[model samples]
Target chain A: MAERCAIVGIGQTHHTARRDDVSIAGLLREAALRALDDAGLDWPDVDAVVIGKAPDMFEGVMMPELYLADALGAVGKPMLRVHTAGSVGGSTAIVAASLIQAGIHERVLTVAFEKQSESNAMWALTVKTPLQAAVVAGAGGYFAPLVRGYMQRSGAPEDTGIRVAVKDRANALKNPYAHIRDPNLTFDAIAGSPMLWDPIRFHETCPSSDGACAMVLTSERAIPRPKLAPAWVHSMAMRSEPTQFAGQEKINPVSGQMCAKEVYSKAGITDPRREIDAAEIYVPFSWFEPMWMENLGFAEVGQGWKMTYEGATALDGDLPVNCSGGVLSSNPIGASGMLRFAEAAMQVRGQAGEHQVDGAKIALGHAYGGGSQFFSMWIVGSARP
Target chain B: MADEAKPVTNIKTPMRLEYRYSAGVATSRFLRGIGQGKILGQRCPSCRKVYVPPRGSCPRCAVPTVEEVELSDEGTITTFAIVRVPSENIDVPLPFASVHVLLDGCDIPFFSVVQECPVDQIRIGMRVQAVWVPKEELTSTLQSIRYFKPTGEPDVPFEKLKEFL
Candidate 1:
C-alpha cells in the first residue's frame, strides 16, 4: 500500500492583471515562503520541489524553472517542471504528492505561476505558421464555437452564461486573494457586456492575471502540528487525448469523464454531487461552468444549466463550486489549476474563511487544458481515508 | 522616495522570432491541390476516415494515410462563432463568422471564415461553399480559398450533424 500524503501548507499571491511590484522569482518566493510558514517549516525542510506553468512564451521566459531553482530552494534537490498547458498547476501538485505517497520524500513543495503582463497571451496563442488557416482568434474564439455546439445540444437558456458570470463574480467578493471583486457586477451588466466572441460575452471570459500558488505536501508520518488542519489526499488522476481527431467529443470530452470517474472511484465516492462538499473547477469561460458540471458527473447531460438556474452551485448550495471565485475571477493561467487544488484543500481544512462551505469535510479539485483534452483532478478530505 | 527618484517598475521589451516551418509531404500535397482549386483529403486505411488538410497520419489509428480523396467544396457548418474582437493574426473585418465546415464526404471539419452573408445568418447546419481567390493569386497555401460563402441550401438537420459536433 502507498503511504498517505497530507497537504499541510497552502499559499497564493493576490492575483491581478499585472503584478509589477515583483519579478517572477520574487512573486514565486512570496507564495513559497508563505506556504513554508503555514507548514511551520523552512526551505531546508523540503526534500524536493516541482514547478509548473503555461507556455514560456506567455511570459517571454524560456525554461523558467532552471532560473527559479534558488527562489524555490530546489538547489541540490530534485526539481521537475511539468507542462500540460493550463492543467500544469494541478498536475504539479499531484507530482509533489506522489513523492510523499511513494515514500520517496518527507516533505515536497510545489509551485505554479504565470506573469502574463510580461507578454501578450493572445499573441502567444495566435502565433501564425505557414500554410495553415489563422482562423482561430484566441482561446475565446476557439471555445466559442464549442460553446455554441453545447447550447444547441443542451437547449439551455440564452442567459445561462451570463448567470454563471454573475454568480462567480459575486462569489469573488468572499475571496480576499481574488483578482476581480466587482461588487457591482450583476446579470444585466454581464448581459450588456460586449460580445467579444459570440456566445461568450466579455465578462464571461477570464482575465489575464499575474499570480502564483504554492503548497507543501508531507507524508502522514511526517505531518507536523500546523496552524490549520491538514487535508489528506484521497485520490488523484490525470487523463489526456489528442487535440483533434475524427469523431472526437469536443464539448463533453471523454478524457475528462474518464478522469473524473477514476478519481471518484478511487475516493470511494459513488455519488459525487452528494458526497463532495465543495469543488474548485477550471471555468475560464462562464459557460464551461455548466459544461464541466456535466463532464465532471456532478450533473446529468443537458441538465447542468438547471443546477445554475436552481442555485445548486452557489456558495450556500448543496455542492458549492468555485467558492474561491474560481478562474473566472482570478485566472493566472499557470496557477489557476493549482489555485483550485489549493482552494479545495482549504475548504477541507476549514481555512477558506468567508468562502468556506459549512462543515465541508470532503472537496474536489478539477482542471482541464489544451482544447479540453487534458484533465487532472483530486479528492481531499479533513478526515483521513 | 522622491517622485523624481522613483524606481522604474517595468521595462518594455518587444521580441520577435522568425521560423522556417516546413509543410511536410502530406500538407504540401493538400496545399498543392488547393492551389489547383480542388479540395483533397487523406483516407486512414484502418478507420477509413477521410482527413482534410491531412497531417500525413490518422491520429486515432496511428497509421499513415496515403490514400488521397477529393472532396466536395460544399459543406455544412457544424459550429460557428461571430468574432467581434480584433486579432493581430486575422485580417478579417470585425464581427466575422468563423465556422467549422464539415465538408461533404470528409469526417473532420475544416476551420475557416464565412463571408458575403450577414453574421446572424451563420448558424450550425447551414450549407456553405468555398470561394477561391483569382486564378493568378493561387499559391501553395490555404489562402487560395479566400473565404467560404453560403450555398443557399437548406440547413442540415441537427441530428445529421450531431456526430460532427
Candidate 2:
C-alpha cells in the first residue's frame, strides 16, 4: 500500500471577476503564501510543486508554469504541470497527494488559478476552428440542450434550476471568499432573471471569476506535531472517455460514474448519500447539482432532483453539498476543481467556519471537464484509515 | 448501461472568437522573417531538429530552440489531404489540397494550402514553392505566403519523404 497523506494547509483567493491588484504570478503567490503560513512552514519546507489550470488560451498565457517557477518556490525543484481542461485543479491536487503517497515527497504544494479578466472565457471556449462542428454559443448554449435532456429523462419540475440557484446564492453569503454573495437572493429573483440559454437563466449560471486555490499536503510521518486537525486522504481517482461518439450518454456520463465508484470503493463507502457527511461538487450550472447527484450515485436515476428539493444537499441537511457555495458562486475555471477539493478538506477538518456542517466527519470532492468526459474525485475524512 | 439510443449525425452551430496572441520572441522573429520573404526555422541544439513557425521550446528535447536557420521557400509535399467538403473557414474551393510542406533543411513539415494543381495531381513527395504576396504588401503574418505552387521538378523519393511525413 502507498504511504498515507493528509492535507495540512489550504488557502484560496477572494474570487471575483478581476484581481487587478496582482499579476498572474502574484495571484498564485497570494494563495501559496497563505497556504504556507497556514501550515506554519516556509518555501524550503516544500519538496516540490504541482500546478494545474485550464487551457492557456483562457488567459492568453501558454505553459505559465515556466514563468511562475520562482513564485511557486520551484526554482531548482521538480515541478509538474497538469492540464485536463476544467478538472485540472482537482487532478493537480491528486498528483500532489500521489507524491506523498508514493513516499517521494513529504510535503508538496499544489495550486490552480484563472484570471478571467485577461480574456473573455466565453469566446475562448467557443472559438471556431477549421473543419470542426460549430459551437456558436458559449458554455450555456452548449450545455442547455443537455440540461433539457436530463429534465426530460427525469421528469423533474421546471423550477428545479431556480431552486438550486437560490439555495447556492444564499449559501454564498456565508462564504466571504465566494465571488457572488447575494444575501437577498430568492427563487423569484432567479426565476425572473434573463434567459441567457433557454432552461438556464442568468442566475443559474456560474459567474466568471479570477481566483486561485492552494493546498499543502504532507506524508503521515511528516504531519505537524502540534496543529489543528488535518484531513486524512482516504482515496482519490480519475476517469475519462471520448467526448462524443455514437450513442454516448452525455447527461450521466459513464466516466463520472466509474470515477465515483472507484473513489467510494476505495474509501469503503457503501452508501454515498448516507456515509458522505458532505460533498463539494463542481456545479457550475444550477441544474448540474442534481445531474451530478445522479451521476455520482448519490440518488437513483431520475430522482436526484428530489434530494435538492427536499434540502438534503443544503447546509442543515443530512448530507451537505457545496457548503462553501461551490462553483455556482465562484468559478475561476482552473481553480474551481481545486476549490472543491479544498472545501471538502475544510469540512472534514472542521475548518469551514460559518458553512460547516455540524460534526462533518467525512466529505467528498468532485470535478468534471471536457464535455463531461474527464472526472476527478477524492474522499477525505477526519479520522485515519 | 441503458439501451443505446439512436446516433446523432449532424448539428449545425457557429462560433467566432477574437484573440491577441503575444507571439513571444521566437514567434515574433519568425513572423518578421516571413513578412520579409524568408522562411525561418529554429534548431534545437540538443536534438538537432529544426522547427518551423518557431515555438518557445522544442517538444521532443524539452529545451529552447534558439539558433535561427533560413529555410528555402521551395519544399516537397510530405503528405496532403484533398478537401471534398466545404466549411465556414475553408475559403478554398472544393477539391483543393492541404499539404504538409517539408521545407529544405528542416526536419519537420509545416501545414499550408497547395494550389496551381488539380486535386488528382497532388501526391506525396511533390515539389512545391511558396507563393508570397507582393513584397510591398507584406505583413508580419503567415498570410504573407498566399499558398504553395508546383515547382515542376521530379518528385522527391518516397523513401526520403517518409520520415518527414
Question: What is the lDDT for A106 in model 2?
Answer: 98
- List DockQ for all candidates: 0.80, 0.02
How do the residues A207-242 of candidate 2 rate in per-residue lDDT, one tens digit apiece? 999999999999998887425778999999999886
Q: Is the docking of candidate 1 incorrect, acceptable, medium or high quality?
A: high
For each candidate in the order shown, give its overall lDDT on alpha carbons. 0.93, 0.85
TM-scores of the candidates are 0.98, 0.71
Off by over 4 Å in 2: A131-133, B1-165
Once model 1 is optimally superposed onto the true structure by TM-score, how far is the C-alpha of residue B90 displaced, in angstroms?
Answer: 0.5
Chain A only, candidate 1, TM-score = 0.99
Highest-TM-score candidate: 1
- List candidate 1 segments past 4 Å from native: B1-4
lDDT of 1 by residue, A286-372 (tens): 999999999999999999999998899999988898998999999999999999999999999999999989999999999989989
